[model samples]
Target: MQNKLLGVIDATTHKNGIEDLITNRSMSAIPFAGRYRLIDFVLSSMVNSGIESVAVFHGFQNRSLMDHLGSGREWDLNRKRDGLFFFPSPLKEPDSDQLGSFKQFKQNIDYFYRSDSQYALISNCHTVCNMDFESILQRHISTHSDITEIKHDGQSLEMYIIETSLLIDLVQNEETTGYRSIVDVVRDSRNTYKVSEYEYIGYAALINTIEKYYKYSLEIISPQIWKQLFLKDRPIYTKVKDEPPTRYNKGAVVKNSMIANGCVIEGHVENCILFRGVKIGKGTVVRNSVIMQKSQIGENCELDAVILDKDVKIENGVTIKGTETIPHVLRKGTIQGALMNS
Candidate 1:
């Protein structure tokens, strides 16, 4: 990616079937891998590739998204010139609904105009992968394509690079009802425009539902995938937490787990992802679970194949178990005991 290339991230839409995790925040803000949000993967990829000018379009309950991406300084996106720009929701009418990226982009066309970039890289924040967008941009420029899309598993990552003029034309005339989405415009214009495809030979993912989320979360636990995504040459950056390292008490027994900082373990955790400030009380058992930030599990509690959202509290004497394909989910700030099924 060159300095002339600008990045645009779609963080406005709501992802269905993930209501439990995305009720209060955009899907991009969803926590992942103990210490990272889904957006970090994409943002880091762009920043690592030397693309400084970036815009994150946000809506549908975006306070957490705002807090998480303050100033974009962490990713080195806060700069003198083309730096991080956030386009907030513009649907302020009484009857207007929550905004989406297309509308947000249309309203903020001045950002694109003043950017002076010849090309733009557009992507959704849901896919969790570490990719070199420079390759994608090179292919787009070499092929002289109007739009070059990256695909994996027969579906577009919703990642594309387009000539800025073509994007302007498509978006400027998007007054009709049928062409609200970028996909729709690209599809409808295929006959008139030159569209190309580049297969991504990396760990491309689509985590839309809870089951898929749980499945992918566990899949990354594989050392190969973990190394490829997080520990590669270009590191994945996130908000720095200056907490101390995790502490394991005398009775602690952890195996095949990824534990982050600010955790205290006195029980057993197997094949789990423990985020910052999580506490596993003595005698508690966690297997095949993902416990997010600041959650606590009381003693004698047993959790298997579960996804506990942030700030959840599980009392003692509870055993919550679900199958591998369909893990039970406890929503954010939930308090659970023996009777609660969530």
Candidate 2:
């Protein structure tokens, strides 16, 4: 059978209660890695996988996403039959309370089911990774799993892991031999067993599962209970990443850093996460900072613990060592020794 249609949910939002302040802006659109945006990872992966159709669910602050992913021309997602689509959040809902991420996803259920495709691939844009979906689809078909959860290494301890076999059984409702709560499956080793399939990489696979069994609103459905019901019995599959993981470029000198794409550095950097399109002049020193997109730092400027917002400019001979414990936030401009957060 032809591979199912693919749907990608940008699911990124500004911190709640701050949406009005940053209207039409999405967290996914936030610039990252030097020159690349965060959504690029997901979009690129989808494009590379030969999945032609993609829909980006924009919640708020989506202008950046719209700007960067314009018409999906760059990734060749602008096809006549299967191309990139932008799904804006519905402005008029009968019940405004259904505004959370889960609810927003639930509202888009029609898009997933209405598609002529047989399978669905769902993912978020918060992570950056290289994935070959052809292999994943092969594994999914061979295993005949209802749901496939992708997991990556280096996740925090707070994350949870579920076995594929157990997940399949739970979703099929074949685990119950007597009266028991769904959580009991986790406790009962005999009924629930582990299978090495794909780890849950915060992404999920649904083989028409949602279209088949979804009844109640996503807001009312408890995630724990849902996991217990479907995931407890369903046979979950795993896909281990055997290839060498990708890392930052070696020519890039990042210190105490969280660096993203589209960056070129030939200077000394310490304690910074430089976003995309950030350029550090040679012979410059940056310490304890968070620099946003397209920002430039002149040579020989010593910056200590500063948070430079997008498009900020720092001129040469500007020594910015502040006494405040909290790093100063520098707006867009050329400055010297400007006290941030003052």
Give the per-residue lDDT digits (tens) of candidate 1, residues 1-342: 353678988877566678799877888899999999999999999988778899988765788888888898899988898889988757542112122245667899998888788888988878899888987888888898888888997788888888777777767776754556567656775357788989998887877789999999988888988877875588888988788999999999999999999999999999999999999999999999999999999998889999999999998878899889999998899999767634
Q: Which one is best on lDDT?
A: 1
TM-score of each: 0.94, 0.56
RMSD values, in order shown: 2.6, 13.5
Give candidate 2 regions above 4 Å deviation.
14-24, 91-102, 105-110, 154-197, 200-284, 287-290, 296-300, 305-307, 315-342
lDDT (tens digit, per residue) of candidate 2 on 244-332: 22233444466555565566686788756676667787677887666776688877678776666677787766776543344455554
Candidate 1, residue 279: Cα displacement in angstroms equals 0.6
What TM-score, to 2 decimals, does candidate 2 have? 0.56
- Per-residue error for 197 in candidate 2, Å, reads 5.6
- CA deviation > 4 Å runs, candidate 1: 1-3, 91-101, 176-178, 339-342
lDDT of 1 at 154: 73
